[model samples]
Target: DAGVTQSPTHLIKTRGQQVTLRCSPKSGHDTVSWYQQALGQGPQFIFQYYEEEERQRGNFPDRFSGHQFPNYSSELNVNALLLGDSALYLCASSLGLADNEQFFGPGTRLTVL
Candidate 1:
């Protein structure tokens, strides 16, 4: 079975632009969560999606939003990006309701110029 997958692995953008990163959950999983890991910091939860609706959200601004598809894949979109938004965007997957160990993908490193 395929593990979680994220892309494009690396990204570069300007401070005012927008970016959309993608993720495919591990096989047999139905919940997807997005995390932001700043340099030298632990991953901070952005939001979680299950059943195609947002189930949980973190202490982030409205600029961070996400979507989940029926197939269990997901996408994270950041609008009007700021330099502070430059970080490693990680996607984690869990089966059914959360609480189990989450499986993470190699994150997408975003750099805002």
Candidate 2:
């Protein structure tokens, strides 16, 4: 079975642009979470999705949004990107909300120029 997967391993954009990143959760996993990691910094939780609904959110602006499909795949959309938005976007998958050992995909690196 395929583990968690993300598209466009790297991306570059200018301020004010919007970026959409994609993720497919690990097989049999239904919960998906997003995180942002800046240079030299640990990952910061962005939000989490389960049952096709957003269950929890992090300390991020409204520009960050996400969706979980029936198959457990997900997408992360960041609008009005700022230079500060440049970072590694990570996608994690688990069986449930209480599962602490989530499986993570290779992050998508976003660079705002």
The digit string of per-residue lDDT tens for model 1 on 11-74 reads 9999999999999999989999999999999999999999999999999999999999999899
Reference-based lDDT, each prediction: 0.96, 0.95
Cα RMSD of all models vs. native, in order, equals 0.7, 0.6
Candidate 2 lDDT by residue in tens digits, 20-107: 9999999999999999999999999999999999999999999999888888899999999999999999999999999989999999
Cα distance off (Å), candidate 1, residue 83 = 0.5
**C-alpha root-mean-square deviation, candidate 1:** 0.7
Worst 10 residues of 1 by lDDT: 94-103
For residue 79, model 1's alpha carbon misses the true position, in angstroms, by 0.3
List the pairs of residues colliding in candidate 1.
none
> What residue pairs are clashing in model 2?
none
Name model 2 segments beyond 4 Å from true: none
Candidate 1 wrong stretches, greater than 4 Å = none
